[model samples]
Target: MNKNFTLFNVLPLVIGWIGIKYGINWLTIIATTVIVSRSIMSLILSAKLHSSLSHLSETVRSRYRAVLRNPQLTFSVAIINMISLALWGQEESLIILAIATGAYFSVRHQLLRKT
Candidate 1:
């Protein structure tokens, strides 16, 4: 499979892990800097491409609404999160949750691709 990386994809994990190694303050500072940089780059690209900010925002808004509108998906995710939260103190629960969550996403992705 091909791995696609973007600012939103890779930066947070790398920076957050590094920050954890250093300190909470370092994490906040690095995360804020990265977010600000990404935002500025987005603005610059949008200006160069003559894309309307409202159009971009509308696309994101619609996607959020689409996800919220899917009752099955919304309830499934809520149940998953609730299970994880309920078993918050148990390592086994987390392991099981991760496996189940990963499988759910993988199956969904495959089904979507075929459709």
Candidate 2:
């Protein structure tokens, strides 16, 4: 229905896919569920935004593209996820919170700029 909703749906699916590749135990399952749910939401929420993929800086674009093209980013995100998960059981919560914060900032800066 909206871009943010779309992003919310897509972000988790992408994140979950990464988690599945690099995740361990129950986390992998959680990631898979998130992936499926996000994918559905993303598809339902499609809008008129540019390809999220097209906005990357040249260097980042190349690197991330390479990572996405391969399974490396999944491993990397997995590692980070593992570490975050290890951090006193607060990892997932914090990461989600951080993601939400980032999303808020992005929406403000890009879609809702104050002039």
* Top TM-score hit: 1
Tens digits of per-residue lDDT for model 1, 45-93: 4343333323445555455345434347423543544353343322433
How well does candidate 2 match the true structure in TM-score terms? 0.24
lDDT scores of the candidates, listed in order: 0.44, 0.44
lDDT of 1: 0.44
Runs in model 1 lying further than 4 Å from the true structure: 1-4, 17-23, 51-115
Residue 93 in candidate 2 has what lDDT?
46
In model 2, residue pairs whose N, Cα or C atoms come closer than 3 Å (at least 3 residues apart or on different chains), thus clashing, are 1-45
In order of listing, the candidates' clash counts read 0, 1
Q: Which residue pairs in candidate 1 collide?
A: none
Give the Cα-based TM-score of candidate 1 against the true structure: 0.32
